[model samples]
Target: MTTAERIAAAPTGTETAGHPGPLAYPAARAAGCPFDPAPAVDHARREQPVTRATLWDGSPCWLVTRHQDVRDVLGDPRFSAEATRPGFPFLTAGLRELITSTSSSLIRMDDPEHARLRRMLTADFMVKKVEAMRPDVQRLADDLVDRMTDGRTSADLVTEFALPLPSLVICLLLGVPYEDHDFFQERSRVLLSLRSAPEEVRTSSDELFDYLVRLAESKQHEPDDGIVSRLVARGELDFEEVANMGRLLLIAGHETTANMTALSTLALLRNPAQLAKLREDPSLIKGAVEELLRYLTIVHNGVSRVATEDVTIGGQTIPAGEGVLCTINTANRDDAVFPGGDTLDVSRDARRHVAFGFGVHQCLGQPLARVELQIAVETLLRRLPGLRLDVPFEDVPFRHDMAIYGVHSLPIAW
Candidate 1:
């Protein structure tokens, strides 16, 4: 049966119906199942993987939950990512306002503009280039672990090691001084926060833009071996575009990786058997990373898209101008695609997971992110042989209010 038909015929009082409405776009995670997607997401995947949904602004759209359906929506060019589009699904009014008020970056633009701008920065994140930096990444990971474990029986892994590794790496990659990490990190938190006040979001965005503007301009006069300096030297993009690009890279580069580091570590600690297996065989690190990403799928929100043409998928017709929320979290957790999907099995072949997303907009920094995560995970377990959570797993604070999902402060003791 078609997904919509199935949903309509199914029993009532499902989690979807218990909400503000049956089609609420943003669903909440199950109380005890913090790592899994919301019960609503799971319900959708099982009974009606592609069904109608109501966005935050009371706009109706299609919520795609199945793995292949999400792939179809995201990979198809008819679906646009432009935030300025009339029916684009925005998570918050603050985010919509921020996008409209500022110059668009690579994430907001479609190809060939997206391709052109992305081309300017791709060289730095290419697998070979990032692979060559493994020594540096490993060194940084070791140094942070040394500091985190030294003179302290316990540490907030979020701030001590997880947050700093990627922040420092991105700073070096972008030519921004490592000393200014606190400045950007705080502003980024405000910007990514789902609960930030409108004024706070606006101020943080403007401040970040202004900082990038100065940094990009300075690079013109004095070139450095950073991504921003190289883009500035290219001279193809204007000052505003360059600054926006820098802002996008700076915020996105670190935030996602940082969250993954912290969350993945927490997941491992919780799954002691998996942690022991990984510890026993260092060769499993690559597959373990993929499994953790699939299990956590930290980017809780789907990658938003606006339909530009009428399309039919899973027997539901999505008309032009409607929004589509390709719920990645659900797709990754899909039981059909990955057997025993909810359970974390580090040795599973999870290479097909969409944790980095898919299609042309797939994460450009996947290579760098993979390298950093591998090093960080390996170093943490190798260095702190008896690492475990200091606080009760239930007591660990989660970033449910932020666009990215992760632990706020993971207290660790070895």
Candidate 2:
């Protein structure tokens, strides 16, 4: 049966028996509960773990909500990440254009090529490599907190602390100048903003690409320890390829980490008891970071793939060429895997959460992200024991329009 036919036949009402009839994919999170997944997501998880949904382009796609089912689809070789495919489901039109038009990054490519390019940066992100940077991360965190709490009762945490810390780290790693953060961050914002027009996104993306291309070329003459420099010295990839890879690292390394830092802080502040646990025992910092990552699951809109062949996920057989979306927030909150899944429990063992996704395409920079979160969160609370939201909880601006979920500006007082 056609996707439209199946949706028409599926039961639908105020609630559903199984997959509801043509529910919208990328449902909005419930108001006043920014940390939780949309109520519709939980309904789908309970009623129909795998359901069909309509995308922006009017494509019918499988929306997988169950925990294991999400992993199954992500890990399955039959599912392809090729954004250029005709039937591939894209999160936004701007993103679709960017992915199709630009040189393929590690995330956009599959297997052989993906593995080869990813291997180039694997050692840079390995546990030991990331651990070596712990002192640097700690210093950065300390300096950020100092700036925020220095003779001020309140500050915009998003700008002052959350965003810049990660941006600087990624800048150092990618050999991009720290002074250019404002330039790239604005461009990255435009690139990831759901509200950005296709032309705006394209223009910003082109500017960033050209800048990276120039940077990559300069690295050819002056090799350094940064990622772009290393790639230049190796002479494996051409300028376009190196520029594209550097662009991917720069955006991914900062944007996701920045959101997580701010959003996780908001999540913890909302749950004072949980926040108290972390402040009381510094040893829980590592586990608390894991729990926060699982709870917030900031990259809510990113998990997507196109089926290369027919694949059965959560008892539903998706046909070849169909698009599949693994809604990470709902999957992490799966009741089967996490009882009382919505509650914030810092001590809970959340190592199994697919917040970084799963399979061969899983986030390569996860170790670095984790270390940054651990140090950033731990140091923030330790330095500012009096920290709390400066404004009404409902007043804080949330980034619902962005492809990545986070706060736009978090006002806090220490």
Candidate 3:
């Protein structure tokens, strides 16, 4: 059966073979509206708000769907981010194995350790530090557009422009050679695929891990001006630890921003009036980016956290040792916070979105991401005033099967 059909047929608070079964977590989005959250998720947000759902392993977890409840759960320390904790929810067996078998990054650690590791890279992504890189980011975006459109009327924006921009910037920052992007990008795809086997995830992750380790070790002798070199010079972390941190940065640094760029362009194209507003007033680019982030929350799988202590949320008592999935995509659509939330409005004040997540574990690279999106969307519109999809809207492939939500490839013409 197709994904949408499977989701439709899934037991929602229904009895199955004399046993009650919860609706499936990570439910598929409605087939036609690829940009919105799963229809079941939206129903839960408006109806139950706090209800139980079953994971791939048939494990039951609380699904916190309301706007305030999602924030409360994510912000509360009682909910642990540590993935190895018992009852911790995993969307799929492969993801469970991938995270548990690898060295924990800041995303998977609680306070003290998470704090310590996060501190090492705080200064690098600080507002001022990232702001200083704006000129370079703008130049890179302009240069990419020039090269992409030099003599071409059509191209796959994903490979030609969107993917390369962030990859180039991240390589320069992390000291990884950009020419080797093919190797890492291929592995990253495997790592992010929901259908990848546990062994496939392990092999791909190990390959990337080994590559980062070698790069980190080399930096020890001949240091450069990159984050890895700086970390090795300080000697605060062992080479393996440094590699673990570098691996997270390298994959996350480029993937999220690249997908956002391509997807944002597609969103604006679908909403012509919204795109026209930005073209008329360049100042709206910043807010437009925020609105787009809220409208297309690309983290399709909700954030996972297991409760360390009994907690009451959305009038539901979640006992200690239970797992909770904060449906941020649904929360972003809550009308309580964002009126007319489903529609894309460039003028809307959407800075309150949980797109980068919330609380201490909130994305460490948000400053850099915001700047990159602002420049990317603005530059593209400014340079390609005639930009339009090269194919029918329904023909564009969406990343429904992948962990991240975005277009698989965006073909465009100007």
Top lDDT hit: 3
lDDT ranking, best first? 3, 2, 1
- Per-candidate TM equals 0.95, 0.95, 0.97
Report the error of model 1 at residue 400, Å.
0.6
Writing each residue's lDDT as its tens digit, candidate 2 over 112-176 gives: 88899999999999999999999999999898887777888899989999999999999999999
lDDT of 3 by residue, 1-414 (tens): 555676778766546553345668788877789889999889888878888888877899989988899999999999999998998999887898789999887889999899999999999999999999999999999999999999989999999889999999999989999999999999999998899999999999999999999999999889999999999999899999999999999989989999999999999999999999999999998899999999998887889999999899988899999999998899999999999999999999999999888989898999999999999999999999999999999999999878778888999999
Model 2's alpha-carbon lDDT is 0.88
Instruction: Give the 10-residue window scoring lowest on summed lDDT in candidate 3.
Output: 12-21
- Candidate 2 Cα misplacement greater than 4 A, ranges: 1-11, 14-19
Return the TM-score for candidate 1, rounded to 2 decimals.
0.95
Q: Which stretches of candidate 3 lie over 4 Å from their true place?
A: 11-21
Better of 1 and 2 by TM-score: 2
Candidate 1: tens digits of C-alpha lDDT, residues 101-196: 787888888888888888888888999999999999999999998898789889999999999999999999999998999899999999888877
Clashing pairs for predicted structure model 2, backbone only: none
The residue pairs that clash in candidate 1, if any, are none
